[model samples]
Target: MAISEPASDQRRAFVLDLPQRLVCLLDGASASHGRASLLLVVVALVAFLPGFFQISPIDRDEARFAQATKQMVESGNFVEIRFHTQARNKKPVGIHWLQAASVTAGEAVIGPSALTSIWLYRLPSLLAAVGAVLLTYWTALVFLSRRGALLAGLLMASCVLLGVEARLAKTDAVLLLTIIACFGALARAYVRPRAERTGDFRLAFIFWTAMAAGILVKGPMTPLFVGLAIVALAVVERSGSVLRPLRPLVGLVWCLLLVLPWFVAIWFATKGAFYQHAVGVDMLGKVTEGQEGHWGPPGTYFLAVWGTFWPSVVLAAMAAPFAWRARRDEKVRFLLCWLVPTWLLFEIAATKLPHYVLPLYPALAILGVMAIERGALARAGSRLAGLVWLWPVLAILVSLGLGGAYLWFGSGFGLAAWPLLALAIALLWMAARAFPRVGPEGAVLTAIAGALVLYTAVYQAMLPQMRALWISERLAAVVKEQGCPAANVSSFPYQEPSLVFLVGTDINYVLPNEAAALMKKGGCSLAFMDERFTGNFEKHAAAHGLKYHAVATISGFVYNGGRLTAITVYRSDDAPAGSGAAR
Candidate 1:
């Protein structure tokens, strides 16, 4: 009985331990899942936030946006976008509003003039990028496993174009946020039965709200893109009623309610001029003609996408065939409906900016992750196999070539270029080993990680040097150093908006004919003109009784990879003789 009693005691101990062990296992899994979620967030911040404010404001778009936000803060005009008293009605007020809010908040902390802090202008986009990444994870989880969700988030967060847009004060990053939100709601609405969907109106609410927000971000293109995807899904599913649960009438009401207030206010303020410029010139012009010299063949975006997506491009490309083959599957079908039509629309559009197709990338990332989860890459010895090997091969070669070029030609990078080369080599080694065994997820992560490292090194080492070469900030500073009053300086023939922000006061963008007269009427007026137009300015100056001498020769790349412009700074001494007659 005593021996029997010992065995019974042992059995009781085992029984008690079993549930505890299960509880511990559950706890561990929950903890691991939480950590996995955090990993992507950390990766996103690392990808986006570092050196974000370190680089000078990029010219044209970024500077234009910043200046508009500055105007919003100064003029207290929350609805209309303006640049130095000129209405910029092309884009919606969403990005400018957000930037204004950031500037306002930043100024409160750092004093009123702190609106000039470029990071504040860019913060919304960074947060939006992080939001987009998180939303992609959620969308992936709706149809994918936990690992797939993480991978999708990482892939989108690390994409080159997305990252670049995120770091800028551009509309695309925020536009992406609204896009993912709308798609996320669409994914949710589609997954549930029609009967069950009506029980929860939250999804429809989310979808409508996001659509309206997106429209605010970039005008009708947002709705057009999302509506086309929704329509495509309905058609492909052969259920015209697939969108029934969304209740288009109700959603439209919500969209109009959210978007109308500002649109109406701006229209009234500008006396319909806003619509004429925005819809007529900016929006319609892009549709009918290549606005802003961005014309390209239909395949322009298709070719550009590979480089934009980069490190993940091979897997994404491989995933397409498999994705198409499995198009009958509900999630795959939804992704196809979401990705293909929108992608085609952008490709067919008259204007082709790299960021125009950004809204389609989350779907692409989800599809790429689905392929990995489905063992598609494993079957092919992963993305590292065959001609896919050329990706890393070319990447390494490019890295080496760029590093050599920097060493030989570019200034300020110095020995720092070699670290980028090392990163490329490490990526190659990882790809060679991991792809065949660990598959696309592992190989792609290695590549993305290496790319991030390379970018950080290059940006840190080269941004200041690049800024010196690209932005007008240094030239503006030089003007300030020379005691040129902000109001007394003007740019001739060209209005680089960056000069407005960097110079700290509005510099008039004067016409060639008007520049000479203005200089002659004002004492010691300073004019910054492109070197190419010096002869034209000299002719006008000689005729207008303005004696001008080149103050300094300031040369730099207009922007990264843009034209190399050497601007001659000229200080004009007014003679006042027959000056007003020339005007």
Candidate 2:
């Protein structure tokens, strides 16, 4: 058992009191919004910025989002979302618009050549990630002390899912921001008594407007979660008090004002195809069954939360007993209502990805802090105390996973990552070892330290060094180095958006023979033939008298499909093309 905080506070301890002191520092910082905000920004940036610029554009969604936004920047089409003329109608225009703005600003500041930078496209996610972290702090303030709120903010900021989302050019990070804000407002209004909710009008605006932003970003997810939580709250409390303060009519009108313009414009532009795909295909498909291969049985999020939530998850486990025992507490009830129904919905849904439950993570963060403040965390003598070992064990497992992946796909031992991996494992071991002495909340800081080291190694060092996995980045590099800046490129038997985003919009997704034909057309034409179709490319090259030479042969795992994809770039030797090419 741990000593009471009141008892610990009496002593002027240094190392033993480090955890309490750290909590005090965060609490002190939260006294001033400016100082807290700055500190959180620094924390968020450190957590998010490791592989932000260094990593290549991830395939499928991230690349598709970036390409669509690049097209938006190129064509100045704000309403119609597209990926190289194909109507990307599955999503609304909010994230695309944000990404477009980020790219445009980047180009202006760093010259037009900066348009292709993946980091520029990812700016929205990064900034939105920061906003989400700050919002987590603010949201916790509604129900928690300043130190607890700050701790919640730190927990969310260092999270694995949020960190991954922050580095990608996708809607999740921004959606997370809007959802946190929207729920934060709703939580603020609901957790308090009706008489005490003086700023009902302001809360209503924040809730509805943030939900509106979520609507524009992912369409209906934000409102869906809020609606469900409110319904659950109403059922549990048997009161209209939660809904009465929001003034639904006015808030809905405000939300419509913010969200309708784009929907209406996209409706006019896509001839209502946007809604057909966005609703009928994208959103509904997930609800009905697995759209992509992301199918899992129930409790997927439960299993995944261990890794995705990471260090916080250790404390979350310790908080479970508290949650059940204190279920009737208004603060506990509010968080339970906010988390449980939404969590059950996602768990029961056929389509499951780790990030689908990201919005629920904030509730966990606040709840964990609440557990700590109340001395409700599972003690060393408790039956659930063995859960502490999960921290260090997961660290070792994660290290092994990384090292095993590198050994399987890398050139050498990946020496750059091993030291950090060792450090991460050590820190996590320390967290677990210190759990009995320092308690769950203090242990969280140590685990987060471990996570930071681990993520830095994974994102900054390990993943980047896995050159065999970034097929598109390497392909783009081959094309750029071949002395044909404006080469008409063809990727045979396979076309990925990352290639289009990094290479050019002029790429042709052609058959092996057609790729060879593109090469025969000469004038700086290059064909990127997948290894599976390399034989066909060569046969067509011979049959068509396409005089071409192999510029480079690259093999890597295509992240979209998670398979080995080998590509050979062949250039027609008939004529040099592009202004930069040798005549």
RMSD (CA, Å), each prediction: 9.4, 4.7
TM-score of each: 0.87, 0.93
lDDT of 1 by residue, 1-583 (tens): 4445587677555434433443343234335567656777788888886569777777779988999989888878788788875778888898898888888889889996576678889999999999898889888888888777777888898888888888899799999999899888888878877566553467778888998888888998678777888889878777655555677788889889999999999889889998999988998888788987898879998899878887677778878778878999989998988888888877777988999888898888989889877877666543336645655675677676656645543566566657665765666555545555444555676667666776675555555455435446666766655666677777865467777877754677886656777777767567778878888888898898777776676766654445667777777755222121100
Provide the global lDDT of candidate 1 against the true structure: 0.75
Estimate, for each residue in 277-382, the C-alpha lDDT of model 2 and write its tens digit. Answer: 8889888899889877889999889999998998788778778888998999998998998899999999888899999999999999999999888877644256
Q: How close is candidate 1 to the true structure, as a TM-score?
A: 0.87
Best by TM-score: 2
Clashes of each: 0, 0
Clashing pairs in 1: none
Residue pairs in collision within model 2: none
List per-prediction Cα lDDT, in the order shown.
0.75, 0.83
Native-to-model Cα distance after best TM-score fit, residue 460 in candidate 1, in Å:
2.3
